[model samples]
Target chain A: AQSVAQPEDQVNVAEGNPLTVKCTYSVSGNPYLFWYVQYPNRGLQFLLKYITGDNLVKGSYGFEAEFNKSQTSFHLKKPSALVSDSALYFCAVENGNKLVFGAGTILRVKS
Target chain B: EAGVVQSPRYKIIEKKQPVAFWCNPISGHNTLYWYLQNLGQGPELLIRYENEEAVDDSQLPKDRFSAERLKGVDSTLKIQPAELGDSAVYLCASSFGSGAYNEQFFGPGTRLTVL
Candidate 1:
């Protein structure tokens, strides 16, 4: 079964600081990794995906993720975090036709 | 293009009561999905539909949970005699196709509270 692990439950960072939310995945074959962000009372918004090629994938809202094959990690990162960027982030791996998701990491950006 | 839409943003029901949630996927989307998200947890797949056909329902609790996407556009998920454990955020998502490369658009979700 394909699965994703987000080690951090919550990450706190000051505004304008760089931020990273770690995620590691396990799959039998090549992994299709994705990142989604959910704001309060809102649906999850797609951030980025790492399907093939390009170790570093850029996504919406000045977000990017590095897909490290040997490390089996797809970590979400931003150069300068915004206070509005605070939300719950989820990492997912495509398993056949379905997607397996991580527990999610809460991002708290303090101004 | 509008995003996926779900109805009844919040609901409070007693255990054993019946509840139903509705969803309307994005226009032109042929694949729809239903997912359950518990507190502090990620969304889990409950059922998936491909053009009005249920292609995947392995994770759905068929004993009490049921869902249908008619006309391959709108969907409804129902729970008969709901259990306390069934309290969670029910999310609806849709994509142009059911492939790994296709990105899914999600709805705001319906939060169900089974007392």
Candidate 2:
């Protein structure tokens, strides 16, 4: 079955340090990978996506992700963590007409 | 664009009661979706619509949940005889089309609580 996995339930990083949220997916064909962030009491906000071409895709709030086809991984990364970046992040893969999502990873950036 | 819109940000009711949630996708978006999200978990797709047709609804619990997109513009999801286990956040999202590259835009969502 097609699915996405976020191994870490939560990740902690000190402010100004780089952070990484790991994600891996399994699908039949090419995967359309995406990253989304959800704040407390709010709906999900689109972060970035990897459709084709460049492996490194930049998005809102200084977030970027690297898509590895061989590894079947699309890990979200930020060069510098901010306290405001603390929130729930989700990784999703679009297959055909439906989107399969990973459980979620909570990122905590301490000041 | 106005982005996706959902009504009744919060609702509380007893089990077995009927409830409905409404959603209006961004103008000109041909694809719409309904998702169920439990606390601390990622959202799961309940149904997906292409224009006025429901191309995918296999994830939806037909016994209690039903959805309709009459004109391919606005949509309504109904749950009859809701169970306590059904308490969750119902999210609505839309995109330009069902293409793999098109990004989906989400709404604030309706938080349901079953007593």
Best by DockQ: 1
In model 1, what lDDT does residue B98 have? 85
Q: lDDT of each structure?
A: 0.95, 0.93
TM-score for each model: 0.98, 0.96
**Can you tell me which runs of candidate 2 are displaced by over 4 Å?**
none
Model 2 clashing residue pairs (backbone): none
TM-score of chain A of 1: 0.99
Worst 10 residues of 2 chain B by lDDT: B95-104
TM-score of chain B of 1: 0.97
Quote the positional error of residue A88 for candidate 1 in Å. 0.3
Docking quality category of candidate 1 according to DockQ thresholds: high
